[model samples]
Target chain A: MSLLQTIFEETFKISYEEANQDLAMQDVANWDSLTHMDLISAIEDKLAIRLSSDEIADMTSFDAIKRIVNEHQ
Target chain B: MHNIIVFGTGKISESCSYYLTKKYNIFAYVCDNDFVTDEPFLGKPVIAIDSVAKSYPPNEYAAFVAVGYQELNTLRESKVEQLTTLGYQLVSYYPQHTPINGPIGHNSMIMDDAVIQPCVTVGNNVLVWGGAMVGHHSVLQDHCWISGGCAIGGGATIGERTFVGINATLGNAITVGRDAIIGSGAICNKCIAEGSVLITAETPTYRLNSHQFIRFSSEFNSRN
Candidate 1:
C-alpha cells in the first residue's frame, strides 16, 4: 500500500480500499479540523515535505492531497 | 520510586520531567525512531519508541505523554492512545501547591499552581497550564487545553479539544463546544458552539442558560 493510503486509513479509521483518490473529508467520520491537521502533519513528516496554509486548507480530498504531494516532488 | 518514561524532548517534556522526577525516577525520553537524537534529554538517554518496549518493557515502567497542546491537544491524545495500545499504563500529573478535590482522568496534566476546585471532572488528556483556575463543579472534557492564568467559572463545561486561551474567562455555568478556540483575554459567558473561533477585543458578557450548556456537556460525555 502507498504511504499516503496507509496514513489515510490510520487517520480516518478507514479501510485501504476506501482511501482512494475519490476519498473526501466529508465522507470520513473523523475528519474534523483537528484530525485534518493531524493528517497534514503526518503527511509532512512521513513525506519530508512541507505544505503551506493554503495547500493545507485546500487539501480536503485525496486527489487534492496527491496534487500537492506532486507539486512538492 | 517507579520509573516513568516521558514522550518528547521539547520544553513541555522538560517541565513534565522536572515534576515527574519529584515523584518517580525518569527512565528516558522516548521519541519516534525518525526523530531520535544522539544527545540526551534533561540528563537522561533518549530511546526510540519502537525499541522502548523491548529495552524497558511496558510492565516494568509507566509512560507520560508530555507533548504540548498542539493541533488542539489532539497530538497529545494520539500519543496517549499510542501508549495505551502498547500496554503501557498512563499516569496523570497533579502539580503541587493545590489540593485538587476532584477526579483527574488518565493522562491529564495539572501544571504548577493550577487550582481544581471541588467536584470538577477533568477528562483524559486534558492540559491545565500553570496559574489556571478551574472553579467548582466544572467539567473539562478530554483533550481540552486550559491555558495559563485562565479562570473557568463553576459548573462550566469545556468541550473536547477546545482551547481556552491565556487569561480567558469562561463565566460560571457556560458550555464551550468541541474544537472551539476562544482567543486570549476574552471573557465568554455565551454557549460557544462546536468549531467556533471566538476573538474578542474586550470581555463580552452574555448569559446563556436553561439547558443549552447541559445539552453540549451531555453530548461530550456520551462520546467519551
Candidate 2:
C-alpha cells in the first residue's frame, strides 16, 4: 500500500482502493477540516516530519501531499 | 498610578487602552516606525516602538501588547518575546465582570463577559474574547486566542499559540495541540494533534422556494 493510501485509511477510515491520487479534500465524502488535520497528523507521525502551516494549507490533494512528503524525505 | 505603554494601534489596542486607562496611566501607543502617525491616539502620542525605551525607561513604564491573532497567533507570540527581551514588564488586562479563580500569566487579556472558572490555567499573551467560557481546570497555553462565544470544556488543554474561532466548542478532557486552529461552530470530542486545523462541515442548502409556500398558506387562509 502507498503512503497516501495508508494515511487516508488511518485518518479518514476509508478503504485503500478509495484512497487514490484523484481523491482530494473537496471530492472525498469524509475529508472535512477535522479529518484533514487528522490526516496531517498521521502523515507527520508516519514520515517523522513536521509540516509548516503553509504546507498544511497547500495539501489539497493526495498527489500534492505525496510530492511534498517525497521532497521532505 | 503605574505608567504603561500600549503597543499597536489596532482595534485590540484601542480596547486595551480603554480598559487600561481606568487603572493605569497610559503614556503612549507604540508601534513600528512605518505605522507611526501624526495624530495622537486617545490624546496620547503614538510613537515608534524602537524609540519608546529611550523616552520611558522600562523600569518606570510597563508595556502591554495589544495585537490580535495574526499568523495563527505566531505574531502575537513573537511580539511578547520581543517586548520581554526589551526589559519591559508585560501587563495583563481583565475586565471587572470576568472571574479568574486561578493565576493567569502576564500580558493576557480577558475581555468583558468572559468567564474563567476555578482552577483554570491561562498562559502569557493569551486573549480570551468577550462572552467566552473557560471551564473548570482547563489549561490554555501561552499565546492562544479564544474567540467570542467559545466554550472550552472542563479539564481540556489548549496548546501554545492555538486559535479557537468564535462559537467553537470542545468536549471535556480533550487536548488540542500547538498551532491548532478550531474554526467557528466546530465541536470537537476527541484529541487534536499539533498544527491541526479543524472546521465544521458546511450546511447544505435546499432548492425549494419559500415564497411559493407562503402564497399557498395565504390562499388557504382566505378560503377558510
Candidate 3:
C-alpha cells in the first residue's frame, strides 16, 4: 500500500480501499472533531514529521493528503 | 428539602461529595452496593447507595449516583431510570465552575477547570476531568472520561467508557467508540472502534531536555 493509503487505513481503522475523498473529513458522520486530532497525531507520529497548520487545514482530500506526504519527503 | 446520596468510594466521588457538601443538603454517601457510613459528609451521614432508598424512603429525598466508569454509569443510569419510574427524582449537578451551556445529565461530574461549550450533551456518571474542554454540540455518552487537558471539538460523539488521554485533541464531528483508549497527546481525526488504542508520536530523545539536576545552592535559594 502507498504511504497515504497506509496512514489513512491505520489512523482511521478502515480498509485502504475504503478511504477516499468522497468519504471526506466531515462527510463521515462518525468522524468528529476529536478524531480529527487523533488522525493528525497518528499521521504525524507515523511519518516522523510535523505538519504546518495551513497544510493540516488544506489536507481535506485524499489527493491533498497525498501531496502533503510527498512534500514531507 | 433535597436529600442527596453519593455512591462509590473513588477519589472522584469523594471530591464530588466534598464539593457539593457546601452547596447541597447532603444526607448520606453510599459506597458501592452494601457499604454505608454514618460519618457526617458536610454534616450529613455517608451511606451506601443500596440502603438509601430503604433508609431514607424514596418519596422524601433525591439521590446522586457518584460512581465512575461506564459500567457504573450504566448501572446508575438504570437505577435512576428505575427510581424515576418509582416516582423519585434524580438530582442533576452542573458546577458553576464548569462552563456547561447544554444538556448535562444527572450524576455527571464536571470537575474544576472544565469548559463545556454550547449544545454539549454529557450523560450520567461522566467525568469531565480538570482542564478538559468539551466543544460545541458534543455528545459524550454515559461514563466517558474526558481526561485532564483533553480538548474535544464541536459535535463530537464519545461512546461509553471512552477514555480520552491527557492533552488529546479530537477534531469536530468525530465519533469514538466505547472503551476506546486515546493515548496522551494524540491528535485524532478519525473514528475509533470500541477498543481501539490510538497513540501519538513522542518528541525525539535528543531534543528533549533530559537534565534532571540543575546546580543550586542554599545561598541561591535564600537570595532574590
Whole-model lDDT per candidate: 0.82, 0.82, 0.68
Residue-pair clash count for candidate 1: 0
Q: What is candidate 2's CA lDDT for residue B58? A: 95
The lDDT, on a scale of 0 to 1, for candidate 1 is: 0.82
Candidate 3 lDDT by residue in tens digits, B73-190: 4565565565566455667666665545465776677775688887788886577876888898889887677788999999999998688889999989999988788888999988
B1-224, model 1: which lDDT tens digit per residue?
77888899999898777777777888899998999989998888899988888878899999899988788888888889988888898888786544454567888888767877877888888888888999998899989989889999999999999999999999999999999998898889988899988777763332224243343223234333
TM-score winner between 1 and 3, please give it.
1
- Which residue runs of candidate 1 sit more than 4 Å off their true CA positions? A1-73, B96-102, B201-224
Q: Could you give the DockQ of candidate 3?
A: 0.01
Which ranges in model 3 have alpha carbons more than 4 Å from their true place?
A: A1-73, B33-44, B70-88, B97-102, B200-224
Cα-based lDDT at residue B159, candidate 1: 96
Higher-lDDT candidate among 2 and 3? 2
What CAPRI grade goes to candidate 1? incorrect
| C-alpha DockQ of every model | 0.01, 0.01, 0.01
Q: Identify the candidate with maximal TM-score.
A: 2
Global CA lDDT of candidate 2, please? 0.82
